[model samples]
Target: MWFSKFFILLSVWVMLSIEVESSTHWIVTESGLIQPRLNSPFDMERPYDLLAFLNQEKRWDAIFENYNDLMKHQKVIDALWFDVGEHTNSGTQILQDKDCEKAGNINAIDWHASILDDGSEKVPQEKYLFPSAYHGPSTDVPDCKRISSLTFSMFAFEHLESMMQRDNLSANPEYVLPELLTPIMTLDQFGHWVTGVLRENSSSWLHYHMASMFWRIRGNAPKALECSRRAVHYAPRAYKDIALGSLGVVLHRAGKSNDAIIVLSAAIDHDPTSFVNYFAIANAYSVIGEYNTSLKYYDDSLKLNPGMELLMRHKYGVMCQAKLSLRIKAIRETLNKLRDELNVYTQKQEAWTKLQTEFLKTIKNGEETIEKKAFERMSADNCA
Candidate 1:
C-alpha cells in the first residue's frame, strides 16, 4: 500500500515537472547553444482555466475577458516561451469570431459549449498570432498582414457576415452553432510550436465535417459533397471513410447515383473488411435499380458476416419486394386453385383473407423500397 501510494505521488510529480518544462523547441548548433534557464511559468489551459473561471451568464463576454487577460500578460513575462504574431496563430483566431457571428450570442467556448466552423472562417487579413511573449528569433510571416483585424476580433467585420460558410454545421438538433467554431487569431511563432500545432490541427478545415452534414440535411448536396471530399483527401484515411460515405450519399440524393457508386467503391477499396462500406455500396446499387447488382452486393454483405441476421433479413426483404405485384397475383391464383379442389368455401375465404393481409403488409412496410424494386422489375420485364 505504501509503495502504491508512493508510486502515484511520483507519477504526479513527473507530470508537474513535464508541464513546468513545456517548451519543446530549443536552439540547436554543433554545441548545445545556451543552458536552459527558468521552468515555464506560462501554462495556458491551466492559468486561465477558462472552464473553471469563466462561468458567466454572457459566456462570450467571459471568453473575451479571459482571453484578453491571458494575452495581456504575455508581453511582460520574462520566463515566457513563445511570442504572439497575427498569421501564425491566426488559424485559431477566427474560432471565437465565428461563434459570436453565428449565434449573435458571444458565449461559444464558455465552459460547456463547443464551437465549429464551416468553409467560411472569420479569417483575419494579417498579423495573425495568439498572445505570447518573445524577445529574439521571432519569425515574421508576410501572409499575416494580408487580412486585417478590426477591433479585437480578427477578419473583415466591416460588413456583418457569418464567420463560417453555410455548409459547416451538423443537422443534429442537440448541437448549437457555438459548438463548432470561433474567431481567427494568430499565435507567436516561437521554437516552431505555434506552426506545428496549427498545421497539425488543419485549423482551416475545422468544423468541416459538422457543417457538411448540416448542409446535406438541407438538400444542399453539392456543397456537402465538395466539403466532405476535401476532408477525405486531407484527413487520415481511416478517419476519412465516413466522409467518403457521406459524400456518396449526398451524390446519390442529388441524382448523381453513378458518382455515388464511384465514391462508395473507393470506400470499399480503402477498407474491404468494413461492413459499412459494403452496406453503403449496396444501398447505392439499390438506389440505381440495379437489383442484380444489389443482389451481388447483398451476397458480398453476407460473405462478410453471414451471421448478421439483420443484413440477411434485409436481403430477404428486398427479394420479396422485387417481384412483388406478380407474386401477389400468383398467390391469389394459387389460393383459388387450392380452394377449388377442396370445394371448401369457408377455407377459401380464410386463405384469401390471409393472402390479402400479407400482400397489404408487404406493400405497407418498406413500401418505398419494395415499390421501387417492383418498378425496376416491371420495366425490365416489359423490355424483355
Candidate 2:
C-alpha cells in the first residue's frame, strides 16, 4: 500500500514538472526588455515586489506634478486656445462605483487605499464630485484649475493612455468647458487642444514636442514623424541633440532606416556620449544589414551605459547575427583542426603499437633459437 501511494505521488510530481516547463512565454519588462514569463495571464499577475510598487508611487506623483506644470506653461503659451472665464463651482467626480468603495469614502482621498485607484480617486473631494450627468457645453471659463487639472490628470492616470482608455470609468464621456463637470477627457479633446497649441505657436518647438506625444498615443505614425521633424527643425542649436535623437527614433519607427541612420548620426555628432543615441543608431544600421557598424555602435553604447539589460540584449542580438553569418567558415575551420589532431594521434598510436608488436615477436624468436641450440648440445653430450 505504501509503495503504491509513493508511486502515485511521484507521477503527479512529474506531471507538474512537465507543465511548468512548457508554460512560459515572452514578456516585456517595465524597462522595455524582453524576458521569460511563467504563466503570466494578467499584467497584475506578473512578478513584482509590492515594496517597489509602493516606492514608485512617489516618483509617479512627482511626474504628475511636472506634467501639470508643463501643461500650465503650455496654456500660457497659447492662452487664446484655452477658455478664459470666471471661476465657477463645477461638479466633478473624483471616483465612481468600485473606485469610490476602494477609497473607503465615496468622496475623499485615502492614502492607504489598497485598491489601485487612478488619478480620479486622488481628486480633491472639496473641489470635485461625481457629476449626476454630463453638463452642457459651457463658454464660461469659471474659477478653479482643478477642472483643467483633471484634463491633464489623464497623463497621471496611467503610463500609457491606451491602457487608461481601456480601464477608466469614462469610456465615452462628453466634452464640456473646463468650468463645467467632465466625467472624462477624450482623446479627441486631447488631439484638438494639441493641434490648436501647435498652430498657435509655430516657432515653439515645445508644441511640436507635445504634438509628437499625442500623435504617438493615437498610433498616427506619420503625424508623429512630422511633429518630431518640426521639433528638430525649430530646436535651438544647444537643444538640437534631443530633438534630433527623437526625430531619429520616429523615423526608425516609420520604417525609414536610412533616414533614421542619418539623423541619429547627426545626434551622435552633437552628443557623442549619449548612449541612447548610439543605441538608436545601432538599431537603424541593423535594419539595413550593416552588422559590423551596428556591432560597433552597440559596443559604444554598452561602454556608456554598462549593465543595462536592454543594451545587452541589443548587443547580444547583433552578435548572434554576426556570428551566424560566419558560422559556416567557423564550423569548417574547427572541423579541419579537429581532423588533423585526430589523424596525427591515430598515426602515432598505430606506429607505437606496430613497433611494440614487432619487438615482442623478435624476442620470442631469439628465445626459441637459444632453446634449440641448448637442446642440440645436450643431445651431443648424451651421444658422446
Candidate 3:
C-alpha cells in the first residue's frame, strides 16, 4: 500500500514538472510586434526566403492525429506550427505559403510541438478561422483594405495560396489579391510598424531606415530608390537599423544585390533582432550568392525559433541538399490540381427535393441557423 502511494505522489510530481518545463512564453520584437514564444520552430533562416504562418487547425488535426503529436512529431507534419498560438507566441500569417510544403522540415517543426507525440484533437472545431486582419498600408486606411484573412483551417495555406492565384483571374474573386496580401503579412508588418514609429517620432534616421521596407512592399520600381536614398541621409544610428533593413529588402527585390549588402551591414550595427531583421539580412546575402553567410544568420534565427521553414526553404531551396526539397523527395507526391466540378440544378428540381427533406423541418421549426438550413437543403439536392 505504501509503495503504491509513493508511486502516485511521484507521478503527480512528474506531471507538474512536465508542465513547468514546457510552459509557453510571449515574444515581442524590438518594435513591439508580438508573437507566441515557442522554441526554435524553423530549422534554419536565410535570405530570399519566405515563412508562411497559417491557422490551419483541421489539417493539423489530420497530420497530428493525437495531441501528443502536436509537440513531438513535426517531422511528419508540415505547414502551420501547431503550437504557434497555443504554446508559442505568433499567430496570423507569418509569411506566404509558397513552396513551404516542398521543403523538408514541415514534419520536423510540427512533430517537435510535444515530446510524447500526442496527436489527438481536444480543441473545438479545427477548421474555424481565427478572427484577424492582415497588416495593411497604414492605420489610416479603410477597413476594406484591412484584410480580414479569415480562412477555414480545413484548407491549408498552400491550398489557399493556390485558390488565391486561381481566383485572382476570376470574375468575382473570393479573397484579397496575392500581391496585397503578401506584403502585409510577409514584409508589410515591418513597414506598418515603421509608419507607427514615424508617427511617434519623426527622426530623419527612422524615416531613412523605413524606406526599404516601403519600397519592397510597394514593389521595387525605380521610383522607390529616392525614398531609400533620402532615408540614408536622414539616418540616425538609432533609426538606421530600421531604415537599412528596409532599404536592403527593397534593393534586393529591385535586383541590386551589392547595394543591399552595404545598406544592411550598417543597419545591423544599430541593433539586430528588430522585427524580422535577420531574415532580411539572410535575404540580402542570398541575392549575392553568399549562401554560407545566409545560412549562418539563418542558423542564428533558428536558435531563437527553429520552425522558420519559409526562410529555410528560401535560402537553401536551390541547394543540392535543401531540407524542403529533400523532404519532398522522401514523401510520396500527389497531384494538387483540384477539379472544379459544378453541378447545375434547375430551381424546380432543386427546391422539390432538398426542401422536402433537410430544409422542411428546419424551416418549420425556425430553430436552425439560416446558413445551416440553407446549406443542408442545398447539399441534399446538389443545388448550389
Give the alpha-carbon lDDT of every model.
Answer: 0.42, 0.48, 0.39
True-structure RMSD, every candidate: 44.1, 36.9, 35.2
Which parts of model 1 are misplaced by more than 4 Å?
A: 1-207, 302-313, 325-384
Instruction: Name the lDDT of candidate 2.
Output: 0.48
Model 1 TM-score is 0.32
Task: Residues 46-109, candidate 1: write the lDDT tens digits.
Answer: 3223332122113322323443344344333321222222223443443344322332322222
Ranked by lDDT, top first? 2, 1, 3
lDDT of 3 by residue, 32-53 (tens): 5333342222111221122211
**Top-TM-score candidate index:** 2
**TM-score, predicted candidate 2 vs. hidden true structure:** 0.37
lDDT: worst 10-residue window of model 2: 110-119
Output the lDDT of residue 40, model 3. 20
Model 2 stretches astray by more than 4 angstroms:
1-192, 328-384
Off by over 4 Å in 3: 1-215, 315-384
lDDT of 3: 0.39
